[model samples]
Target: MIDGALFVVVLVGALVCAVSAGALYAFSSFVMKGLTALPPAQGIAAMQAINRAAPGPAFMVAFLGGALLSAVIAVFTLVSWPGEGGPLLLVGCALYLFGMLGISAVAHFPRNDALDKVDPEAPASAAYWRDWAREWTRWNHIRTAAALAAATLFVLALVR
Candidate 1:
């Protein structure tokens, strides 16, 4: 039926988005490691440099792309969610959507906005930079988890 076909497309899109999120998560870890390894003074400098570069645009692109894909999956799942395994797929899709949107709106976007105006070469206190990095990493972890959850759900929907 048409519903089944739509479901298939959504599932594939969800899986692709999930994979992309995982790749982004890995990149985040790499950035964290690089930041953590620096001496306090250099770390602050590096953080400022990164912020000034406006890394937020990249996150926004990724977040929006994933969200759009997940929305498609959610819509299709909703349309045909009365059959066998349909409810499960719906729940999974909902979780993924909620999680992705929540993190983007609550954590990532705020940090990105804050980073936009920071001066790269201006002297910053160590505590401030340390706290900021920790916060960023924490949100990154949330995003990664949500992406994984979304992938798992899509895979389940495909199998069932």
Candidate 2:
């Protein structure tokens, strides 16, 4: 029964990681470009609005939920290591919990918070917007890579 439950959690974690990768991918692939192309004030407005709107339940479920599920998967795999999919699960956990969640906490959210403080219409805010766009996008690209890697690792764990 424990093994069965662990299997279910692993599956859910994989799905969540995949979903997160998609979200990060969208931001890096086109959203940033779209925002960067707009007039400085308009871009800042849109970015601030986007940052404001991005923190709802759906995202929280996938982001925080994935990290939580990965932690569980790691624990379960440790107990059943070698005989089960131990290595794969542990790797997945590190990638999702450390790579994805850790990077977001350390790198991305702080930038968002800083952006929130600057008034988009102010003269300095335009410069802030430019710097913010480049730096945020760079970190987001890192996030996208980490999330996609986590998703791959989780899916592989299931197959193993």
Q: TM-score for all predictions? A: 0.75, 0.93
Worst 10 residues of 1 by lDDT: 116-125
lDDT of 1 by residue, 1-160 (tens): 2346765665665666576567658747797778777875676667656656644766555556667766776676566566655665666566566776677678866776675455544566456667777887887777777777777766666666
Give the CA lDDT, 0 to 100, for residue 26 in model 2. 95
Best by TM-score: 2
Residue 21 CA displacement from its true place in model 1, Å: 2.6
Q: Which of the numbered candidates is closest to the native, going by highest lDDT?
A: 2
Candidate models: Cα lDDT each: 0.66, 0.83
Error of 1 at 132 (Å): 0.7
* Candidate 2, superposed: residue stretches over 4 Å from native: 1-3
Alpha-carbon deviation at 84 in model 1, angstroms: 3.5
Residues 1-160 of candidate 2 have per-residue lDDT tens digits of 2357887898888889889989989999999999999988999888888889888998988989889998888877787766466776788789888788988999888988888777778888878888889998898888778878877877776676
Please give the lDDT score at residue 22 for candidate 1: 75
Report the poorest 10 consecutive residues by lDDT, candidate 2: 80-89
